[model samples]
Target: MAKIAFILLCHKDPDAVIKQAQSLTAVGDYMAIHFDARAPKAAYDRIRKALADNPNVAFAKRRVKCGWGEWSLVQATLNAVETAVEAFPRASHFYMLSGDCMAIKSAEYAHAFLDQRDVDYIESFDYFHSDWIKTGWKEERLIYRHWFNERTQKKRFYAMFNLQKRLGMTREIPGDLEVMIGSQWWCLRRRTVEWILEFCRTRPDVLRFFRTTWIPDETFFQTLVRHLVPEHEIESRALTFLMFTDYGMPVVFYNDHYDLLLAQDFLFARKISPEARELKRRLGVLYASEGARFQISNEGQSLFRFLTGKGRIGRRFAPRFWEAESSLGRERELLIVLCKKWHVAKRLTARIRALTNIPCIEYLFNEAGCDLPDLGGIQSSMSKRHRHRRALMRMLFEYYDTERLVICLDPQNLDLLEDFCRDRSVSRLLEIECQFTDAYLGGHAMRVGLAGERTPKETLNRLLPTIRNDIVHESDRIRDAQFDNHLRIREIDPPDVNARALAAFLSLPEDIARELANTDHLFAD
Candidate 1:
């Protein structure tokens, strides 16, 4: 027995208005749509013509010239309410909405919910006592009435307001009714709405006073509903989910905010961005679905959180915020293939690609003169490689999603070893050790190396041991990390890469594992 009559106050985007009208359609339900009179005649005609076939759709016969913070906005809404009330006498409730509003939940959910609740869903906080009015004239709006629109004729409007202020001229509200204020959107029980209309009918002096009052749409019904319905019968909030900027403009929902919107318990959301076609398309489907339910309120969540992503965010490990670093890069697709010799690495890469079709790239860190043992250049080279590797995982995931590729690292370069060892994208590591060559100095140790930083003999004797120790330390750190530690050591030493190590490293099929073991011959001298 709970049926809704939707009263839509719309201005722009006739196509969107048509869609909004379509969404309001249900058995025994009605829609009374009103477009701004000053809006283009062509758009208004289009909306009417499109809905001509829908018997449930009705439109306001008289268009009202609505403006921001103007009385005509209230008149436009009143026009819709009058049309809906007269046309659909059986409609149990009247829900006011705008063209830009969208249903966040399924229609069935809304019906089932409204069937159980006869209370009027509106916010009617006592205007003077509540903190609802922020950064605007409160009692002043009603006490001084002006016809000039604050938006369209701002200079004249403010000048008149200032003149009235200086003259100390004010008018009293027509009655002793306490002013109540809240959001303009609401869903009222049919009786409550009828009472409001009756109140307006008998109170001609009050209606005349509101004809020029600043933003009467917000206060008129809000005050009337509070008086007609007891405090317990009125739910002090609207059915529509609305958010505002610091300047009181409605926060427009975009495509990226679908999850945040879906998390809200409210039936509908207001002020969807015009460009959010994908979001509209998605929500259009959701409106018809029966099982969709939004039980939580996501008002406390920051906008950036939804803008950034819809999924899990935080550290690489089982991310509870307090214990780990705050990071969002979680596109960890592949285990690492660390090898010094490109030829051996190439063979391994080919074998993996052949078996799993997982693409692999090699010789990344070894490129920028990193083979030199100059300590200063080593630091500089690490910085450059870090810069290069920063977006590497994200790009790989973008190009080749979950079933993607591998990163080949040079184990000889301590920078590559250190960076990839702790990298979140690198799941685990398999180091293919080949014959260690002094080929940089033609099988001989030089007294002086690149940039005159360190000789080959000096590096081999002093730095090599420390570098080895550093690699061990990093590997140990990775294996023994408190969380998200995916380092598994499967050393594929050439000429002796057994089946056990291959099985330990890759979870590939049996035949692929055998083929990977056979790739050890590529490292043979």
Candidate 2:
């Protein structure tokens, strides 16, 4: 009977996943690996052969052709968990993780930590009534029926976003259960795993509903666990540390994250690329020297102390990383929007491009599948968008000349940029972020500086909701002389303000939304 069973959902890199599985063999922990059904035959064969000799590791009988934000991801995870449980009935815990995840702590240390804790570790938040994730975005995930992308097998269904915005297609939350959203990765006790398997078998309707929802993987397991178990029995923080780029994408672990990874108290770290072989080697060395009991070895403790400060490593460094900056010559000007409102971002980019020769290289997050053209280097590269935002940012910084860069971070991307820039000295760079104040912007929401440049902070505040309204509604009425005159005379109070409030204000009309939806054909050629 295995003490721990690791269920790994792998897609891109098999070698790293195999190494991760190897690290768990200290106590004869079983592992069930599920390769994506769509993965190339060659890649799948390589993984199978690599683990064929190991009796403890098994391949999932049911492989899923998984897609992001689709039922397939959930299906794959379920299949792996079921396989692991069936294979090792005496396994005390099931650790659900991705191929990209690497064990930072030794297996003995992890088991010891889990042994002492009576609660399941899974990050969760009130998906129904929480301000943690914006209400509009959350509702969109709840109400709208997001379809699978035929091409890349992802949740890039722009049509759903458009229809939801235009027609406001929505369904009431299930009365029986409250929706929960969190990190897809979690470690559950055998009892909890069994309950989940049983809950899933019985609740086909819930599964069907989440089938077409955006990023259902983040919600399905979390919602089920919250429903099945007592609130006190669950620890909301999943013991994994993940970093994000300034653009809210996952940051792939690299050599620069060496100090950060050592400082983290998390048991696992994720999205490590093959390039970080040295870092991977260090982790492998760390895990190799495990004690007989479920605790860190003396060597492990020494390594921790040597890497970090005098005391034991704490959770304070969980979401931090050294900035990977370049000393290139070109003064790169970046206008980064949290991308809640694509049209506003596009318009802002256009305005900036027209005003100056300063290149307005923009990364727009397209929630709605409007086939927006790449206007003057403004990109809608969903392929690149899907990559870890940190990796993407690193790639950008490495490739682009960003010596003197100016970035505008919206509310969502602000913290990400802070973490990404923590290790670098950005004396020449300026970061502009939107903040709410009592002061009004043209009878609308209170505003902050535009793109953090040297402009008068008060004057640049006018570019927010007003510019947002203009782009979202596809109307210049707010930009007209009459609107300006009215704003000067009377301050029209804005509604409840948020990062996405501007997006919600200008609801898409049915005709326009449908017409824009039709334009998806533009990219078909």
Pairs clashing within candidate 2: 158-369, 249-389, 432-452
lDDT of each: 0.69, 0.59
> Which residue runs of candidate 1 sit more than 4 Å off their true CA positions?
26-28, 295-525
Report the C-alpha lDDT of model 2 over 1-525, residue by residue, as the tens digit. 227788888886777767777766645788989999999878888888888888788888888898766778888988888888888877898888787777787666777778887888887899866665643466777777877563463345775567677986777666798888888879888999999999878888887788877778888889988999999999998777775543557867786555445445577888777798888887777766666222221122222222232222121344424323432223332323333333344454454345434344454333325333433233346554433344444445544434322233333333344344343333121211222232433223222222222223333343344445433332222223121111110012122222122222122244432332232221110
Model 1 per-residue lDDT tens digits across residues 201-319? 89888788888788887888898888888888888888888876545566788997776677666889987999999999898888778776564534322333222332232224343
lDDT of 1: 0.69
Model 2 regions lying over 4 Å from their true place? 134-136, 150-156, 164-169, 291-525
RMSD of each: 20.2, 22.7
TM-score: model 2 vs. ground truth: 0.54
Poorest 10 consecutive residues of model 2 by lDDT?
482-491
